[model samples]
Target chain A: MRGNRIRGHGLAGYIVLSVFAVPTLFPIYVMLNMAGKDLFQYTLRPLLPTFPYHFENYLYAWQFLARSFFNNLVIIGVSTTIVLLLASMTAYALARHSFPGKRFVFYAILCVLAIPATVIMVPQFMLVVQLGVVNTLFAVMLPYAAHQSLVIIVLYTSFSQLNESMFEAARIDGAGHLRIFTTIVIPLSKPILAAMAIFEVWWLWNDYAWPSLVLSSARLRTVALQLVTFVDGMAIPQPGQEMAANVIAALPIVLLFLFSMKTFISGITSGAVKL
Target chain B: MMDKPQVLAGHRSARRMRDVRIYLLMLPSLVLISLFFYYPAVSGFIYSFTRVTTRGAVWAGLANYQRLLADTRLIASFGNLAQIVVFNVIVVATMPLMAAVLMFRMRNPRAQYAFRLMYVFPMVVPMVVMIIIWRWIYSLDGGLNILLSLVGLESITRAWLGDRQLVLYAIMFVNFPWMGGLNFLIYLSGLQSISEELFDAAIVDGVGPVSRFFLIELPLIRDQIRLLVLLTVIFWLQRFELPLILTDGGPGWASMVPGLRMYHSISRDFNIGYGSAIGTVLFILVFGMTMLQMRLGRRRAAADNR
Candidate 1:
């Protein structure tokens, strides 16, 4: 009977979903369509993909695309690795260990979570200047890793929930803190680690606000920064070339999300606790 | 375990070594936070009081704040941001709830998965791309007014981003079918976490779907709604990307948000001290709100306890 009642709404649900989903998807569809169309024609026939399809738009945009994309990948990749290591290790200690003033340490990290990037980014820029890393990837990665306090809290909750007996048995076997962290806790917490990595990567990849400030040099700019330069700065980039650049910028993360939808989605639902 | 002095001493040393190792392992994150997070934050506040230049920062007292108070652009930007927060909160809070209700009602697992995939797909698309696409769509001859005119609403068509009044709404409404990219999935997860037995019992008692939803699912998912609302407010407050990309704070600053104002203060205006002042204000706003939120969380926990 429960099943039958649920089945009753199936048809109506599809109609309703189509109503919302189609328009929800329309802007993206138009984007993809624009990317593949002629620069001159898309303005006139903005709704449909034009021909002969300017597949060459992508080809033309490719030269200006590589360097920024590479910079984004490098910065995001390095930062994510550092975030995972630091968040996991710190969270593990906060969870399993009984060190002096542990609760204070944990809450201190959590307090930092309340401070938004906007507040710190200005001085962060000043700090970058003071450190002489103003235009380097290190400048981006340093602030990037430091802001993973929320991730630490998320992983802390995950780590703290592990059965206490498991750690006890390891300790009874004369396993040290480092070994147990490596052998038992880390292996056991791969899912959270993966989730943390995915969560960090998604944000770090698309991050614009900070990187735009820090990486002012053309060669050091991430794809996000390059996208801004493409649109806002230059009149040279056409509708076609710009759309191609936008599509190119968006493709990797879109592909990443598609391939790991479950992991990515789960990671997000849990980690949406982030500011 | 303490039968002999030798055994006790060995155990004490081992435990001390473990504690020392634990602290050592925790050092990297501490160092990074101290340098990048706390130091910058403290300095950011201090810098707000000093005029930063290439040569060195000099004391500027309340001059930056005084200037900010007089700046018409800053005042107008705050007004715009307030409007954005209201509309953004409504749209983000409700759209996903509606979608989640539909998703929870859908019987077919395959269809549910498909819809979830479709809704969440945009979240992965870089935000810059989304802003760029909208920039085109809202262009004078771009798709929006073109589509609007073709639908016979020709009288309403105008330059979407060029008109200061219209541009704010243009930024807010561009993702029109804002089934919302990420929060949709978050809401779905929240709805799915509800125990089926509650629904079964409500049905047995002859409650209608609407009653059951309001009386049960709505209250149950308060945490998710609150979580989403909190994150949306905080995230949007600091958000500059859309304004920076979509309108560059507009033909006249219609969409100039505090975040963008902060960016411009440092980058465009070349007043690091003033930017820091802006950042400090933003920080205080968020910090005050989050503290209030934590107080509410504690109150809720106490209620649950009782």
Candidate 2:
């Protein structure tokens, strides 16, 4: 009787979940299907493909959107690394040690997190232009690093929850602060760090506003910025090519999410629930 | 005795040295934050008061504020944003909550995993790509219309995003899938933390699912709901990419949101002062809403704990 009840619940859950899943997957499926078709066929028949699947759209997107995509990758890679390192070091100090003005500094960081990035975006642009890093990749990295400090604080809170006796044991064995951080703290904080890394990666990868502001050089555009240009630059109204570009743009992140879904979900949940 | 006092003094100095070491470790982040964050934040506020230009900013005092008030387009943008906020808060708050409840009742782990993954897939897709995908789906001969026609609801097959009347709601539909992951995750966690014994207790008391949810689960996860509502408001008020990509704030600015309007005012028109003013207004609105949310959240948390 219990087994039957459980099976019934599972069947019901599957049905309900599928209903929700359609909207999620349908758009991407349409994009893929449309991208594989020729433009003439797309507009003329609109419903059916008149030709075989062409891999040419991906190649075209690569050539056209290559610079921006590379730019986004560079921004994501560098900024995520910088944030992870800086945030980890800072979080370690805040979590494990007592220092003057620590409480004030922590609260100040929280306040900064509350201030929406949109509010500072215009002024930040002005500052970037004045500094003459406008239209440069560095322009993208600087603000991203700044805006991402909150993640550091979040990770720090998680790190603080670790048992103190472990640290004390390492200290008693004469391991120094840097050694403890490198050999002990980092390895144990893997789950949270991985979570922060994935979150930051997704954020920087898809970020549009700052990149749009700073990267005026066509060669320095990110994927998101490139997508905007792709749509705007289309002269013959090719939905297939546009969809192809989106697929190319979306593939890496989609793959990353699939591989790391459990880690990502758990990390986000743990961080959020604590708050 | 002199030696003993000297040893004690040395011990104090060593503790001070450790404190300095901690501060030194923290220094890099502090410097980065000060240079990049605090400096820009202060300058952002300062810039709001001045007329910034290629020649540099001059003290404009209340001129920018007055301009913001008088600009019909700016006012219209705020009005549009208010409506978007209402729609967004309702959809984001309600839909995911329902989906989450359905998710919690499921017994099979595999089915639950699949559902959770599907819900979160949209979040993984970049915002711009998602917008493009939605645009294609909402096209005149796009999948949505085709699906509608097949279901014998051909009258509902109007240009989904292109029609001025239906555009905003269409935008909301796109937002729905994007928000599901976060809300579902929050609700799932809240549900997991609720003891099964409580549900059993309620069932024994002859309470139905609806009443049990209201009298038990709803009151328990009040904090999550509050947090989600606050986050929904902030995100909606600052909404940009969807409007920017899908409508370009068009069909005659029918979907012109404040963030996009602020972008257009400056980027399209080079109206720096006007854009800054608009941004300041949005900042104030978000700040006010967030403050209200925090207060309510605290009150509810306090009451629940009691």
Candidate 3:
């Protein structure tokens, strides 16, 4: 009877796990199938991948949305670069030094992490309008970077894990704080930095609301916003090619996820750092 | 005495220089974050009390807050949002924990690795695409209803997004396969970090797998559970993306939440002050929830230590 129960439990485990697997895998198949077919084939063979593949769907999808992909790339690049440079600087200072107001700055940033973007967005939007950066990429990237003090805090924990003696020895050798930060701190934290880089890049690529609020011009929309605009009928008459735009919008993130899977997972698991 | 005083003075100056440089290094981030994050966050509180116009913000006192309290649409949206939060918290909190356990239980290393690969692949798909694909799935003549007709279950099939009664629940349960994505991975990491010796000791004491998990694993992984719960509440507090993408907060506000309402209010009516007022109230609620959980966790830790 004990042996029989053991066998039953083993079988139950597999069944339960397979059930979880279906939702994730099924959508992927559906998305690929949806992207592969035209409207007629989509109607008839919605679940099946039938060819001559309708590659022209991409052309239709891109007819009005191509500019958005470029704009998204620019925003992602600018935001990620600014976030990395500034976050590393703030993190380095917080990790290695003692100064007046250091505790205050750190605690303020901790509070900032909990402040939802939806809440402060109204005033943030006003500030952008006041700065005369409304309808500008700088508006999007500035908030994107400033709001990344959470990333700084995350990076701070990693920076704290660096070897103390190396930094002090460099300091003893008359190396300035800038040199020690650049030479010792940056090199030692490459793995975490790389992981944060991948995450911020992927994140900025998908950031929709901030851009939607800040960038009003049709010409300045990101790929994610473009898909929304297209589907909602504000952009253009893109006939029956949403799956194509959806596929394109999802592709870069998917490719990046596959490439940097290890670092991405590590970054999050690291975020589970004890308190 | 003179030599010692000179040496100490020199050391103090060097220390001061390092401190100043540290401040300088942090300068750019401080300035940018102040202008962008802190200034606006503080401004949100101020703006909530004003009526913003092309003529700049004019003081409106408690007018915006008074309007917020009486707004029927906002109240109904909160009622709807409360249901989403409870349902989301229950599903996202428990489902992923169970999956993490199942993954943790596997004996075959290769199988464990393969299952992880399968689960992790979906994290890459942009949130926008996921919502869009789900929209198509829920379409009137889309994959779901079509498949239902083929199987002779057409009566249950209906337009998922359009019908007011079904729209909210439809949006909630639409994530097929219902995998809790990153939360699942986080729990797995939490489980993996638990010492193997604790489980071995339990086995030696004749504990069953289920008993071992409950008695040992669950208590050990409380940190992960707390983390996920906190994150879920914070994210859902300002929940807009789902309603925005799936239904546009539509069919007469069945699926509308406060954030989307705020977005619409500011967009359509240009009621910036009222919108800021709504945002301020939400920040207080979410902030309080997070702080409470954090305090509870700390107390538990203290108790454990004692």
Candidate 4:
């Protein structure tokens, strides 16, 4: 009787999960299938394979998008590194030290979180233009780095929950503030930091609107911006090629999620609850 | 006596030096926020009060706000956003709550893990890529149409995004998959935190599963629900990528929301002041909703504590 009950539950779970999973993943599968087919085959049947496989379309998309994969890497790499360093240091000070106006500063950061990026995009663009950094990687990286103080505030809140005695002990061992932060506070807060890093990486990698406004040069276009090329002049690229580009664009994040699913889930939940 | 006074002066200097170092540590983030965040936000507000031309901004005092009030297109854009916000509240609130309850009922460990992971997969993919993939699915002879045909519903398959009436709702449906992830996880966490002893007590009172959910679980998860609703409203108002890529506010601006409308006014028309006014309205709407949500969340949290 118990065995039967267990089997029934398992079956129900599988059915429910698959129903949800198919919609989530179906687009990627369709894209892959479409990208592999030629234009003639794609438009003729619309469903079902007429060809084995071909990758020539990816090359065309790569050139059309213009420095896409490389540009995206530079943007992500530079922005993520800057965000991590600045957020960590700021978070360390806020979490560990007590200063006048600290509460005011923290609340200010929280306020910015509620203001959508769209609200600031126009003025931010004008600011970037006046600085003569338009169409450059710096325009993308600077705003992203500046906008990341919220990550620091969130991290600091979690880090503050740690015992202060640990810091005192480090100080007793002749460690200075910088030494204590790097050796003690940072290592102990790894879980929260990891969570913040992955979350921000995903955010920066997939961001579209800011990049669209600040970056118009073909050579500096990020992957998300490059995906826009598929609909050039309102002519949709072959379904297969469009799908292929999406698959490539989505691949890194998917892999990251699969590997760190636990942290990603926990991090988001923790952050939300704290807020 | 001279040596002791000198030592006391040295201690005072060291303390001042430490305080300065702390301020230096905070300097970068403070400056960055002032320059990049608060500066633009304040200037954005100021620009809304002017007339921006090819040369520069000229004082237009209330003209931009007047234009926003009189503009039919902007009004329609807000109406469209209201529809999305309504739909988002329903989808984001109810669907995930149901999924979370079902997830709680399942006893098998591996099944639970798999279900949780599957739900969150959509959250990992960038919104841009997700929209692109959906565009393919919504193509006339694409996956969705093919599926409709296979199910003997060929007449139902129109260009999902092409029809003026159906375009907004179709775009909403594309965002539906994301509903499963964050909301489900939050609800799950809330459920797990409820004490098992309370469930046992309810069972002893002869309460069934449905009543237990209503009498026990609903009250417990009220805070999470309120937060989720607030988040839904903000996200719906701010949503730009999906509509931008999918419909591009097509079929005579039928699907245009405030975000897209603001983008269009600036990028297409270069009417910066007008665009800033629209943006200001959007900011106010979002800010008001957030404040309302925070107030409700706080009240519920207080009540729950009591």
Candidate 5:
């Protein structure tokens, strides 16, 4: 009976799902199709794929967006690395040690999760100005690195659940805090750390509002910031080139998805659930 | 007795000293979070009450709040935000739930995985790319209009983002049939947690599809529903990126939200005090909603424990 139900639902389920999939996948298909067309071809056939594929659109977009890619690489790379290193260490401290005021410290870190970025954005801009880092990549990187609360929280739970005897053995072998952290805790927490890193990278990559505020100079534009500018700032926007740039902007994340599909999905879901 | 208590206190203090190295491990995170997060939060609250200028802040008391009360754009933006938030809450509850249910019920594991990938893979594209495409779709000569003309409905085709009445809905309609991303994943995960035996028993009882959903799936996934609802409310309440990017809260304030107003205050006018006021207001709303969710979550967890 159960098997019958499963088979019964299968056809209808697939049909309904396929119908939904069309709209779900339409924007992406449109992006790739239009990306290969020149303005003339786009005007001629906007919805359907055109022949004599114009790979030059990608070339032109690459030329336009090359700097922003480099900028994003530096900013996201430095910030995510900083966040993971610092957050893991902090999580280790909280998890492994029975420190004085541990509860207070844990609560302090946890409370930052409640403070939405948009809430603090106004005065944070002022703080950035006061520190005199406006229009620099540091303006974006510093805050990104600072907002490591989610990472720290997630790592704390994982680290706390780790086998205490492993640390006890390491300590018996006269391993210092640094030694134990590098050898035992770090190795054990690799999966969680990787997930957190992917989550952070995805977030910082998607982030536009903060980067838009801080990095005003055309030189320091992140891919997201640059993509928006490409559409609006152009004298006469080329639809093909614009879509091509959109693809370029989205390329890293798409590659990330291809490589670590399960991890990418779970990472975002876990991060969001904690929020 | 006093001396004994003092000695015990000293011993505890000594233990704290030995753990000082652990605190040192945490110092960097603490200092950075304070500098970037907490400090600004407190200062933003202060700045909301002061008149911030090029030179410095001046004590303006309730002046910024008074202006905020009288501001027409802010009021309209809040109204717009309400409509958007309501629509999103409904969308969050229905579409993702439907897709997740369908995916969960699929028996072929490979087919299920393929469908899951097909649904989620598109979200990997940065949201801005999708938004920009949607902007084009709503443009005069864009996809929607072209489709309308092709279907002989060109008479009803209007500039989707330009019309005042339609702009908010246009912004809301960006990711149509929004059965993807975090919400869908959360719902699917919730469904997968249900035991196979329970499902088999339900099937043995000859429960119909709709009845199975209402009886088994719906009750079990209530926690996930509550979570997504809370998340949806909080998300739509503060996000103005759609408005800021596409119509720019325009066709004259039709799509404005408080978050966008706060953004303009800083970026366009450097009206820091007024912007801070808006931020403070949004912060209170977001924080209050979050606390309410936590309380309800705690109550539910306690009931589950019982």
Candidate 6:
């Protein structure tokens, strides 16, 4: 009797959850369904898939977005590396030591959270212009690397939570700060560091506002900038091709999630919670 | 004995050297942040008080601030923002919290896990792609209209994004159900953190699902609710991406937002001073809200201790 009651509750829960899932997953369904359709098929059946899927939409999208894909790779690669190196080294120092001016250093980075990027965007653009890097990839890369405050805060908490006795043992065996950081700290903190890396890549990959301001040059445009202008750049402006490009743009993060699902989910949850 | 004092001084010097190395480790981050963050923040404030043109910046006193007072487009933008913020903070945010509580109470662990994965999978898609799909959905001859006509609601089907009265709500409706992102994960984790004993005790008392949620889960996740609401407010306050990309604040400035206006000032009009003033006002509002949240958190913390 008790088991039956519990089963009844489960059924209700399943029904409610499925109702919510429909709208959430609807767009993904639409994207896939329409991605292979021609204009004629799309008009005839806008809500469902038609016969004879046109796989060439993927081919055309790949050709259209090939260069922008490479550009995103280079920019995200360089910037994510810069953020990880700078933030981890700094986080290590702050977490392991208790030196003078420590509080000042911590607050200086923490306080950046209060100042939204939207506020300083204009002057930051002027600064880029003043430095004579207006049309260069550095215009986006430098600012993105500077977005290290959240990573630093997250790493600091994880680093401080490490077993202090392990560090002491390393020091006694003649391991210096750099050696300890590389061998002991880095290895143990892989999950957290991976999480932070994924977070950085996710945001930088998806960011359009800052890149749109600086990267007007066609060759330097990030995937996001290219995706927004994807239809415009095409010769014929096929709806199928546009949806195909959306799928292509979304592929990298999806692959990353599939491989590291645990880390990816935990990263987003904790990172935003800390903010 | 004299050599012991000398050795102590040597140890102190080595410690001092390590501290200096710590400073060196921090130098790259400090330099980059100063160049990109601190320097522009200070300059953005200074520019708000001046008139900036192609030639140079000049002192304009309170002129920019005064112009902000009379700018009707700016006022309308804020009005639109208020509607967006209210809908998101109150209505949109609740669904995730409710879903999370139901999942937390479930008897089947495997079913719970599957539902969680389904919600989180869409997050892998770049937000821009989602927005593009939504833009297409709201187009005149789009899927929404097609579906409406199929169901015999053809009279109500029209251009969702192009209509002034419905444009803002359409933008809000992009992620209908709003259960696909960080908010859901945050709430689920908050629910997970609650003690198991409280749930068991509620079950023993034969409390219904509704009563258990109201008395136990809702009050326990107060912190998460507060955080998500503040995040939603701050996000809606500054984000013009939807309007900027979807409509470009168009159909005759129906969806114009301050952030989009600021972008236009710099990119299109070259009116840097006015943009900076808008930025300053937004900064004050964001900073003030953040401070209010901190104060409330402290007060609640103190009361809990008492």
Q: What's every prediction's RMSD, in angstroms?
A: 2.6, 3.7, 3.6, 3.8, 3.4, 3.0
3 versus 6: better DockQ goes to = 6
**TM-score of every model versus the real structure:** 0.93, 0.90, 0.92, 0.91, 0.96, 0.95
lDDT, candidate 1, B160-193, per-residue tens: 8899778888888867777857888778777887
Instruction: For residues A140-240, write the lDDT of model 1, one tens digit per residue.
Output: 98888787788889888899899988877777686666788899889998988887788888788778878888787899988888877877777655777
Give the higher-TM-score candidate: 1 or 3. Answer: 1
Worst 10 residues of 5 chain B by lDDT: B1-10
- Most accurate candidate by TM-score: 5
Docking class of 4: acceptable
Q: Could you tell me how far off, in angstroms, the CA of residue A146 lies in candidate 4 after the best superposition?
A: 0.7
Compute the lDDT of residue B178 as modeled in candidate 6.
85
- What TM value does chain A in model 3 reach? 0.88
Put down candidate 2 lDDT per residue, A1-275, tens digits, no spaces.
Answer: 11112113345556766776777677767777778777777866555555788789778877877777677778888888888888888888888876669898787766766577776677777778878898889998987776656777777878899898888777767666799899888999998899888877776777787788777877888888888888787787777778888998888878877788788776656544322
Q: Over 4 Å off in model 5, which ranges?
A: A1-7, B1-17, B300-306
When candidate 4 is compared with the true two-chain complex, its DockQ is 0.44
Model 5 quality (TM-score): 0.96
- Candidate 6 wrongly placed segments (more than 4 Å): A1-8, B1-9, B294-306
What C-alpha RMSD does candidate 2 show over the true interface residues after superposing them?
4.7
Task: Looking at model 3, give its docking quality level.
Answer: acceptable
Candidate 1 interface RMSD, angstroms, 1 decimal: 2.9
Candidate 5 clashes: the total is: 0
After the best TM-score superposition of candidate 6, give how far the Cα of residue B257 lies from its true spot, in angstroms.
Answer: 1.2
CAPRI docking class of candidate 5: medium
Q: What TM-score would candidate 4 get against the native?
A: 0.91
- Per-residue lDDT of B192 in model 4: 82
What value does DockQ give for candidate 1? 0.58
